[model samples]
Target: MGLALKPTDTLIVIDLQNDFCPGGALAVNDGDTIVPLVNRLQQQFRHVVLTQDWHPAGHISFASAHPDKQPFELIQLGYGPQVLWPDHCVQASTGAAFHPGLETTRAELMVRKGYNPQVDSYSAFLDNDHATPTGLAGALRERGLGRLFFCGLAYDYCVFYSAVDAVAQGFEAYVIEDACRAIDLHGSKAAAKQTMVELGVHLISSDDLL
Candidate 1:
């Protein structure tokens, strides 16, 4: 059965940035392939929000910031375990910009995350510490947008976390699976989907909406 998008429902395009695409510093395999579908999906929603992974140079999530560390290694932080990543998406850099082919004109709001050098932000609603609010929740609430549909980037990380956070923030969350790609490090994609499903996130596909 097809899902009809309500006017009050919001579509969140997560981290469709240069760094997460092909030829980027930290590219997800075939990440660029989803851009056209995402562009099409956005048109079905009356409200659209775009998120960017706007990190600063030497951000805490980068392996380069930690001596002798390499990308994908896990380390414990004040909040919990953290995954260090390759240097990417620095502020004011090409990698931080939206994917060149992504349609942004339909987006009513843009949320930039991971700018805080002390923490890494995967969820569009909250930083990884699970304390700091990125203000996305409040913004959506104020606009009366309660149901959130998420897509874009690595399905195992940002997209997964965002959908989880959306449910936690009192919004109905759905993941359009076919509209996303995944890094899938060590079965992380499978792990993320299970967690999201357990947490009340609806895992659907682009065909469900379009």
Candidate 2:
């Protein structure tokens, strides 16, 4: 039998934007395939939140901003090791928009991250610096949400980090495995799964939530 969603459980859809989907600047493999699954999952929860990777042009995370740097290259930023990416999800650009096929009318909140030109954000609750918060934690707590179920694009990066942070912030965190796709850069997907397991973030499939 599937686990039932409780009233205190919230679904967080992470970075289901054009740039993360297939045919975009930093496309993830089969990233668009999760949209329909996520749309259906939204109906199972009472509270739904969506996250957007809204980076500014010339953002520090963009490889194009640095001479001789390329996407996926590692760089030492003030926060920590950062993976430079193709200029994607620039604010107000088409790539920054949510996937056209995503059904978001039921979303109660939308958190926009990575807008800071100086620091890149991966977790919806906290920026890479680990000091600045996106205010998601407070919002969830305000709504009395005690558990978070995540589903969306780029599982190895944003989705993974968000689930980690969700547990760190004192909420039960879960990742809907089949409802997400990974970039898997240099085996990041496997590494991320290991890290998430170590952090006590539960991994489940969409069917498990039914």
Candidate 3:
């Protein structure tokens, strides 16, 4: 059965950049594997939005910014627990560029996040502070898009958070399982799934959508 897409549905592709793919500074396992599926999926959606990590050099989220910290280490920031990542998507750097393999031309809007040196942004809707809106919600609302279908890199982080925030913003959200890869650090993937269930975000696979 083919998945029926409504006129109000929008596909949000999160952080499908080079730095999150194979051989990336902080690679997620099999991250590149989703590119083909995402490319195909884009053809099925009328409205598509892509997100870029787009961090600046020496961004506060980088573990290298803190002398004593190492990548993947958790540090307490004013907003909450911040994951110290390796310097990956530095702005204007090749690593920060979208994967050449991705079909980005079909996307209607491209939202750049995590640009502020003082804050880390995982969800495309808002910065980690949860106060600064990324204008994504407003864009969707303006377009009258209500149901958000998400797919892209790092299911446990960006994709997960984006889906949660979508619901919080009064949109029906769904995550395409096979089209996302996860860092899964210390059971984060499992925890994210549980949280999504509680928040009423639907977890589905591309097969279900097909």
What tens digits encode model 2's per-residue C-alpha lDDT throughout 24-113?
Answer: 999999999989889999999999999999988899999999999988899999899999999999999999999999999999899999
TM-scores of the models, in the given order? 0.98, 0.98, 0.98
**Among all windows of ten consecutive residues in candidate 3, which has the lowest summed lDDT?**
1-10
Stretches of candidate 3 off by over 4 Å are none
Where is model 2 more than 4 Å wrong at Cα? none
Clashes of each: 0, 0, 0
Candidate 2 residue 118 C-alpha distance from true site, Å: 0.5
For candidate 3, lDDT tens digit of each residue in 1-210?
A: 356889778999999999999988888999999999999988888899999998989999999999998999999999999999999999999899999999988898999999999999999999999999999999999979999999998999999999999999999999999999999999999999999999999999898776
Q: How many backbone clashes does candidate 1 have?
A: 0
lDDT of 1 by residue, 1-210 (tens): 599878899999999999999999999999999999999998899999999999999999999999989999999988899999999999999999999999999998999999999999999999999999999999889888999999998899999999988998899999999999999999999999899989999999898888
